[model samples]
Target chain A: MEKAQEIIFAGFGGQGILSMGQTLAYSAMIENKEVSWMPSYGPEMRGGTANCIVIVSKSKISSPIVSKFDSAIVLNQPSLDKFEHAVKPGGLIIYEESSIITPPKRTDIECIGIPAMKEAQKLDKKQVANMIILGAFLKKRPIVKIENILSALKKVLPERHHHLIPLNEQALEVGRKFVQ
Target chain B: MGDNESKNEPRLMKGNEALAEAAIRAGIHAYFGYPITPQSEILEYFTLEMPKRGGVVLQAESELAAINMVYGAAGAGARVMTSSSSPGISLMQEGISYIAAAELPCLIVNINRGGPGLGTIQPSQSDYWQAVKGGGHGDYHLIVLAPSSVQEMADFVFEAFRLAEKYQNPAFILADGALGQMMEKVVLPEEGSLPYTVHNWATSGMGKRKQRNIITSLHMEPEKMEEVNLHLQKKYKEIQKEVRFESILTEDADILLVAYGLGARICQKVVELGREKDIKIGLLRPITLYPFPKTEIAKLASRVQHTIVVEMNAGQMVEDVALAINGKCPVSSVGRMGGMISSPEEVLHYVETMILKHFVSA
Candidate 1:
């Protein structure tokens, strides 16, 4: 609560990058924590890398647009290129190993690779790959409880897609396997 | 965490959706808006919900049609609103002038995007001149409200309508794409909880009225136009008391920062970063962009060593701050053009390397 978690999520447009940030913000809001979720918008999003920033804090958040990040969840190589230096020294970077060819070059920060895309391919719903990555991130830093995330998943997932909730929860648990 | 009180519950919602929900709760009778990026959610939300709530939601063919619809609905004693982004709002300028001249009450929301023409759908404050100074035409002003947060985006819906009807003038909510697209937790008001008044001057069909109410902005005679202009000027002066601003850490500040809307949110971080470096910096945020808190700014100008105005555009509001300070303090501005926003570190760099070295003493 003393220090806010400023996080950036970057991936291709189909990688569910924006929704991952939104889900965390929704969970944070559920816990009465101050939350702000901002997405990288405009014409560049057309097949380009889509990204978002999510900040969760106890105190009121001042600026939602920030340069540095306490953590990053990057799903592709281009994202690694853009945000590898963005994470604060000694902070965390959870990257998808399957999509990225070159790993992060930074030695000061903690970089963990979760083969999230590969893991999601095993699941019935491949789109829950982000949730798997989220689960791995939570294993490293449990900012929000899994139960709260499940509740947030209900809100983030449309009603017709509600059937995927349990599978997504399983994917989250699967994500913890890569890190631990 | 299990507070369980509905009133205390905060909903995480996008700024654009929050604006739409607030309008429904604020008891608007109609919504006339075309679809545009970053602002399309407003029209979509209204279309799905407004009709169910016994209100009309019409996606007009164009922004011009939307604004004219707003004028017609407001004249018919209906609380109405229309929304658009920069280019779309530019199309409605003439109708806005007509509504202003007719002294009709309505809400016009512009989620400003970067533009001179068909610019990117990115956030910008370039429309400040169009919003506060006069986007329309001749001798008329709209009560302009610029909000920084998602909560304020919702809250200002009620506030803008209140001010519009109170003064019998059109009101504008000048927001940027960042504020429109971002999601934040908001404590929402109840549905139709806010009250609004229907005025006798509105032509609500004269069934039992002694006099027929006619709504028109046209005046052929020069003297008649002058008389109406005099009345409008007096109303503008009276509305000056409605000016709103927020001061953060200014009481003991050495360097003052002036910004509005989302720029103010960024300056808040500038204040925090400056304080970390033992810089006595404060931020003065203007909420009412049109009323232009000149008196409050002038008062703060006397004590601070120097003032810096920050905005998204190339120093639009800075000129107003300079005029407000009136040579009492040295005023300079930091601005980002197009859709690029000012980062806090870049501002701190400017402050430490440029501003502190010249203006404020260590």
Candidate 2:
């Protein structure tokens, strides 16, 4: 039986946290992996706390909600405080350095603070910070291939944004290279 | 199998979205639904897809109007559906009863949320009595299909349509908020299936037919109404015979876990946990909740020393389990109400104390 990797993506609503989880889930589907993505729904998702759980497994997933995560990608300080303790021992926590003032203090899990906002600014689009974070996640855990994620982008993004594919791909590459 | 043979590619879809897509691919002619959380995605997805497929999609004034619109479309011999959550489903009960009494073929989806009133928009099986026992004021049963997975959410739409038309009865897909909100890989159905065709029974302007079809629930004559009730009872009996259930790891089990939908999925994990500790535990999942799958439960009841019914409600379906067992074994229930999900460990602990520990002492 193959292993199941559960991930939590948490941040502000407009920070692309949900979309990051969605892209990962779609990529997992492209790779024929059993996957489930559950987002924080209701009023809290407007401009407040928002998060999504994405589980990729090789077998049927019993539940979509995760109490403990194999990895967490946090884009803000509150998300760091909220989910840092939920990461499994020896797991990975990736956060955006610009948004989080105090980084995760856990010694058991590997914590990587990426300057995602700065990196996205370098790409001429600060909104793609989530993509940078996603790229770092792929670097840390290469569960799904980068090629699959690119095709998934085409499927998820609307037709009008087709021209932005190159920039997104560049953002992913920057994150992957910077994480090393 | 025709659609399954061709362009059936796996797409990451939410349960509600898959249900809407399946409805279109299943040749649904009309969709009338009011937006309600957890199930609002179903309505939203339909608004785009249904019109593209040359079908009618209406956001009705309210849940009452939505179900009544379904009743009208079903009487016209068009495959139609309406989806809502618990509170909305409550408002739809009167129309649903009318459709069932009229013996019209239509599908109603309840993406159930916690409730007695405007309950929290969280997953719950509290509507078991409402879906299985006929919530509306009548003595008729709706064929209730409880889907656990996103795949089943899509697949069952076709099956619900088929069964509804076969029996000329209103069928329901009784899912929950978790199933509706969560996303999973789903194999989407290909387009182009034969749409519903009940030309003989439909009131289609009496075109080239010797007699006009009258679709109405009220039979003013007492004797005629009795005959109609008897006919419905007979169809329900046939449905009971066609019940679908799944029994897992029960060949040498000491305890049987009876659950349906999401509860069953959680119980499956408990089964693995129990076996790891060398305890004998199995799962009995009811796919067709209306039929209740009593025969299989009864057979297992004779074998297992203890049975525990797990649900997301305060012990509604447990009554059915106890009835099916008929004192062959002790049947009990443990569940979380009002949208609180009992963790698998909590459930396992409950089973250990309630079933295993009790059996050891006895």
- Winner by DockQ: 1
Residue-wise C-alpha lDDT for candidate 2, range A58-146, written one tens digit per residue? 98887676567899999988999999999989999999999998989999999999999998998889988988899988998999999
TM-score of 2: 0.93
TM-score of chain B of each: 0.97, 0.96
**What is the C-alpha lDDT profile of model 2 across B105-147, one tens digit per residue?**
8999999998879989988999999999998997999999999
DockQ for every prediction shown: 0.64, 0.47
What is the DockQ (computed on Cα atoms) for candidate 2? 0.47
Q: How do the residues A10-121 of candidate 1 rate in per-residue lDDT, one tens digit apiece?
A: 9999888988998899998888899999998855554688999999999999999999999999999999999999899999999998889999989999999998888898
**Per-candidate local distance difference test:** 0.91, 0.89
In the range B168-220, model 1's lDDT, one tens digit per residue, is 99999999999999999998777667777768888999889999999998999
Q: Could you tell me every candidate's TM-score relative to the true structure?
A: 0.97, 0.93
Runs in model 2 deviating more than 4 A are: A178-180, B1-6, B352-355, B359-362
